[model samples]
Target: MTDQPVTYSADSRLASIWSAAAASWLPPITLILAIVVAWEAAVRIFSISSFIIPAPTEVAKSLVAQWDTLMQATLVTAGEILFGFVVSVVVGIAIALIIVRFDWLGRALYPLVVLFQNVPKVALAPIFILWFGYGLAPKIGLILVIAFFPVTLSMLAGMKSVDHSLLLLMNSVGASRTQILFRILVPHSLPSLMAGTKIAATLSVIGAIVGEFAGASDGLGYIIQFASTQLDTALVFAALLLVSVLGVAFYYAAEILERIVVPWRPKFNDA
Candidate 1:
């Protein structure tokens, strides 16, 4: 009798990958479907008015009916989110670097940063609208304010938490401050930065909506406001659904970017 090693064929490997992917997604999808079903049943049994609490089906119908308007608003909101998030990343990283490089600056500015973060973002939204008017600028500014802290804090923590032994080794090698920062600290900080960026991405959406709510003629937030005025609860629900989808989509996009940039880092499942 001879013994043979078992090996997976290419098709088998692909099938396994697909199965794993499906298994990972199935539970969440099932839960969402169950909730929708229950919601539909409850609305029908209670004879609920669409003006009060629209069923998922009504929301879906509203989505289709208002697709054009929703898409235009979505584009506007998405642009604000992307632009604001980018600004937040650049400014956050620069601030992080400055604070890390200067002990005095870090000591002086860190407290102010924490204090600023403690301020209610919603309160600031109206002020931003007042300053920047009912334009994209205010929404972008609000998003930047809301999204900035997480990335900055993450980066600072990451840079500060680098192994002291590594710093010592770099010192032994006579590595310059810039070299140590670029080669060691920045790389070490990427994982934390990405984590913060994911959070910031979601927050940016909320910030934009808040700004729109404060003062805007367009965007999902405006749609929600208008729908409420019209008592079109289905439209409100539809817009809310779109916003939720947008936030999740943005979050996953950041996650994908993180994976691309930090390929060496373990994935969420692995961790």
Candidate 2:
């Protein structure tokens, strides 16, 4: 009546909102909630013993009740992961630089790198525990081993991916090696490095847990082992949940850092 186009109907607006919400999170949330409900129902309906498989509610209760202990274990695990991850980044970058700097070194050592990378980190867990002793050292060492290869490989690939024309342009300008590396090579490699960091973050947690499982007196890995031995299924679930949260949190933290550092990376309109 006012000569303006009609607005969307209430139903249409509601549907639009619902669609957006669903697009944002409903699928994953529904799936997770459904799984939890199913898990709880299965345990109750089958009369499963808590010692065998705990209900989700029971695990949540256990987590709440054992908050202090779980928190301490979580802190220890986080410390180990952080230390290991830092070490891996430093060592990985150093190795990548050496390989990229010297062609002879790359040719000579790349095969060994591939060979070691192929070897499962779990296989070396025991050896690391043996060498570093049954302490945080072994756990951190294994974390370093697990995370380092991916970072090194990703960085090397990134460095090599620099455009030939760009390289030539830098050379034409007689740019110093350090200047070219800092301005062009590093920026070009940032996306790859972030991807590698995310993978490394997850693997570092696994490595720390495996090392601790081998032999350790503290941390989430130790808590999991202790829970298993006592048949505390709820506690085991609690530990696993904590580990999952840790991995996700670390991954997203890396992603945030990547976004902050690499503004050139494309941002989606939806995002």
Name the best candidate (by lDDT): 1
TM-score of each: 0.93, 0.88
Cα lDDT over the full model 2: 0.87
- In TM-score terms, candidate 1 sits at 0.93
**RMSD values, in order shown:** 4.3, 6.5
lDDT of 2 by residue, 8-76 (tens): 788987887778877978789999999999999999999999999999999999999999999999999
**Against the hidden true structure, what lDDT does model 1 obtain?**
0.92
Which portions of model 2 miss their true places by more than 4 Å? 1-22, 268-271
Model 2 residue 207 CA deviation (Å) reads 0.9
By TM-score, how accurate is candidate 2? Answer: 0.88
